[model samples]
Target: MSTTTAVDPTKTSSLRSGRRFGDAIFSALSHSAGIVILLVLIGVTFFLFWGAKDALVADGSEVRGGAGLIAYIGPLIFGTLLSSIIALLIAVPLSIGIALFISHYAPRRLASGLGYVVDLLAAVPSIIFGLWGMQIAGSAVPSFEFLNEYLGFIPLFSGTVTTTGRTMLMIGIVLAIMILPIMTAVNREVFLQTPRLHEEASLALGATRWEMIRQTVIPFGKSGVVSGAMLGLGRALGETMAVAIILSASGGGYSWELLSANTPGTIAGDIALNFPESFGVERSTLFVSGLALFVVTFLVNMFARWIISRRSEFSGAN
Candidate 1:
């Protein structure tokens, strides 16, 4: 048989080199976009910190005298953390359960429809939730009167609503509702990403659907779930309108009443309430509060990343 002439290998190399050049150009552009985003963030932080430097200096003197920054942020920090933690406690499990149900328990058609509904809820304006919480949640305050009276033994639930009837519990519930959709959506996505093989293997071994989910799905998605909840918590911590609408400004500091929900206002709510026409020290203080919140949120996210990194080692171990 006559041998045909072989194609020149140099031509193939030249084509690959051209593609590599194009790829390098595209990658450089994409990487530059990320760097620009990072720089923007740094610039914003620097501006805010610079703007608040004077106030921080004022507060710093008190802190140096052994009073600590507590004098400036004690109430705001407490309110922000407390409300966020309560919202987290209520939202995380509910979101996870809803996510699981939608991901695994529901019929495919129903799951798609329900997921759309939940996503719609997420898109609803935070202002609407605030108004609804203020008007509707405030109206429901009387219903919890029994708990207020009996559970008054506990600080949280101890306080009664105003004659107009609104409490901190009302605010926390509003926050919970606002953040639930976020956590649920995140958890659902994570669960959906669970490797099918792991789940199939568990089911093939005569395990119940729930058992398979518990053993194969939830563990795999645990880090993602935590990250989602933490993200939701971050949103709740900085929620301004809803908290402002639901939480009145009267409460100054931590209250012992478990159901009081009325003790202190969150930093975001405080900023919103006070921002307009606020000048000098007050405005500076507000900026500082915002900075503190930013720091806390950043720390939570960092911790979540650390946890997520650890999960890779544990995910397939079982």
Candidate 2:
């Protein structure tokens, strides 16, 4: 037989009251943090607009680029997007392949070691990458002549071959290496999180290892891969030091010929390279470029979020 002791009303009430109080405090703190972030973002947007107003309304001759605001910023925007896209194109496949090998194909001991090495790469400074690109990758400029001979029909490679080795392509390759670890780490974790049950079921159905991965693992982690790619792109877009150090771009010279020495300036690199010497409307113009970068990064992140939240098989939240 068991005896039940009657609870004291005061004690029970006190316990419930304490829990509610704790919950309220936690909720308030979380809400305040989120609100603070939103407020900071709003403040930054307002500040950029305010600073850029003079340049935006000013005459072309008064501006640094000797062109209107749109014309000045056009090449910066193009270069920024082109560099980031190139990084994305190079990093994504390599990241996915390394992740697949680490998560599925490699021995457990080898996988762990390789993952550590990859993750360690993220800690390497951008300055180090820039130096390497300037000294080593820049030396390979002449080598691109081979590709141009065969691939010159492609518009991207059609321009006058660069002898300086400081073209847009060099910086793009540097950015790709810099962002590689981030995407690889994200992809490896996502691939590892694939449901064991699904993998087993695929295998039980007489699927090969590759088939099991294709049918189960890849589909399950597609959302994560997209998110990771976006994150890497954001870094690539904002990268300044490396681009500033590697690109030999002159003024507002926008060119679609990526392999040429006449590389278009990127917004971040332009701002970094010019901000110290900039004055009056020129400084304001730099602010406008910053604002553009802010918008682009924000939109990319939001789009990635929307994609991840969509009712797709990979999202797992349907």
Candidate 3:
């Protein structure tokens, strides 16, 4: 004979209800955290706009005819975009090559070690990179002389090379180095995620390793590569210490001479250099510049997202 044991329905129901309550609490907490983050972003944007409204509305004075919003930030915006673009052009290809090497060419141990080394670069302080750019890279690269020698006919490079070598070209090169590690790390992970079956199938079809990478790995990781490039550009655009330290702030206005000592000034650099002495409208102008930068970065990221989405749709179609 066997004795049957009965479960308590009330207790079981209570346990289920308690779990549901706990889940609800956690769900609400997570949602609250997300809302808080959005609120903080909104608050900061409001603060910037509020501070900049005066500067935005200011009319040009007799002394400084082009002293209004567009004049104040036109060069800064140009410099920021120019430098960031230069940095991305230099960094992206190198980053892809380095990432591909680490992900596919290097031995397992070597790959891991190289990856660690690359990542370690990101951990270094921006101040250190600035210092390195000022002291070592500026002198070592000889970009000024090279640009003047080869590309002097071009308007951007047609300038007298400064002995100090604190030109936009130099700043761009330093920014490239600063951004390289991050781009490489991101691309490395993306490349590594390419399906092994796809790679093997490509090889089975008599495709060489390089060919396989071109057809399979690169296609699979195209969006990731673009993302990595965008991330690097974002960092380069907002870089303050590096640009401030590497560039000469003596010139008060913008010039198109990228190789000249008195090159176009960046918003981040200008803000850092002048914020200490700025007051009243001048301070508000800096906020306006910052707001411009925020908008530019936002638009760039949005453009990148749109590109990624289009690529995804195309991939899905195939």
Candidate 4:
């Protein structure tokens, strides 16, 4: 024989109603947040375009550089890309290696300490980095006279060396150091998240530690490395203070000479230096430069997203 208990209709209805109420509230909150973010992005885009309208349509003579939009903004964009590229080239590989060591190879105690140190490094202010780059680090650039003298045959090293030691090369190095912590932190986290089973299985198949890392770990964390590198690149691109402080204006146009004081001007640096004194067309021109930066940044992010998406197409769903 089976016994059955009658359910209370009042309790059942109340429970369903409460759940529906909570879900509605949650949906409303999430939708509101997304709308707010979208609105802010739209606002920024509107500001950039509206502020730049005057300069975008202005005559070459009225513009700051007296050479028109492309001619003037070209050098700044080129410089920005060049310096950021230099920093990425130096930082990405080093960051990955350090992260791998911290996550996979180091003693737990030492790794814990190192992780804290990296986080602290990230928390340090950008302006402090600028001051340090300008004063302490820039001084070391002159010591690389051998690079200039011996490798002078290369156009990159062929330039009039300055006594102050402020050059594009130093800016790149400073940017590298500034962005290192960010990339390393992301990489370490990603590496740590690699499946224990996958790693162990590779090792159990007669693979050495390095071989397991090469096959299982690197493949799993490759996307993370790209994402982290993109983040570092973004920071490098928008770097205003460090580049402004270290950048000495000898020739504020595009240059292939990394060792020279005659380095190219970045858009952000140029705007910071000139915006206060600017007026009329010059002011609008600066806005146009800002718009250019926004465009470039957006394009870069899109390209990176495309790359990651393409890579994902070849990866297993799991």
Best model per lDDT:
2
TM for every model, in the order presented, reads 0.86, 0.91, 0.88, 0.91
- lDDT at position 28, candidate 3: 97
Sorted by lDDT (best first), the order is 2, 4, 3, 1
Candidate 3: which stretches are off by over 4 Å? 1-19, 62-66, 137-143, 250-254, 316-318
Q: Could you tell which candidate, 2 or 3, scores higher by lDDT?
A: 2
With candidate 3 superimposed using the best TM-score fit, by how many Å does residue 198's alpha carbon deviate from the native? 1.2
Q: Give residue 201's lDDT in candidate 4 (0 to 100).
A: 93
- Where is the poorest 10-residue window by lDDT in model 3? 59-68
Q: Rate the local accuracy (lDDT) of all candidates.
A: 0.80, 0.88, 0.86, 0.86
Candidate 4: list runs displaced more than 4 Å.
1-19
- The sequence of per-residue lDDT tens digits that candidate 3 reaches over residues 176-226 is 999999999999999999989889999999999999999899989989999
Per-residue lDDT value at 17 in model 3: 40
lDDT of 1 by residue, 34-150 (tens): 999999989979988986776788755533223445655777788888888888888988999999999999999999998999999999888999988878865676666777777
Pick out the ten consecutive residues of candidate 4 with the lowest summed lDDT: 10-19
Instruction: Choose 1 or 3, whichever is better by TM-score.
Output: 3
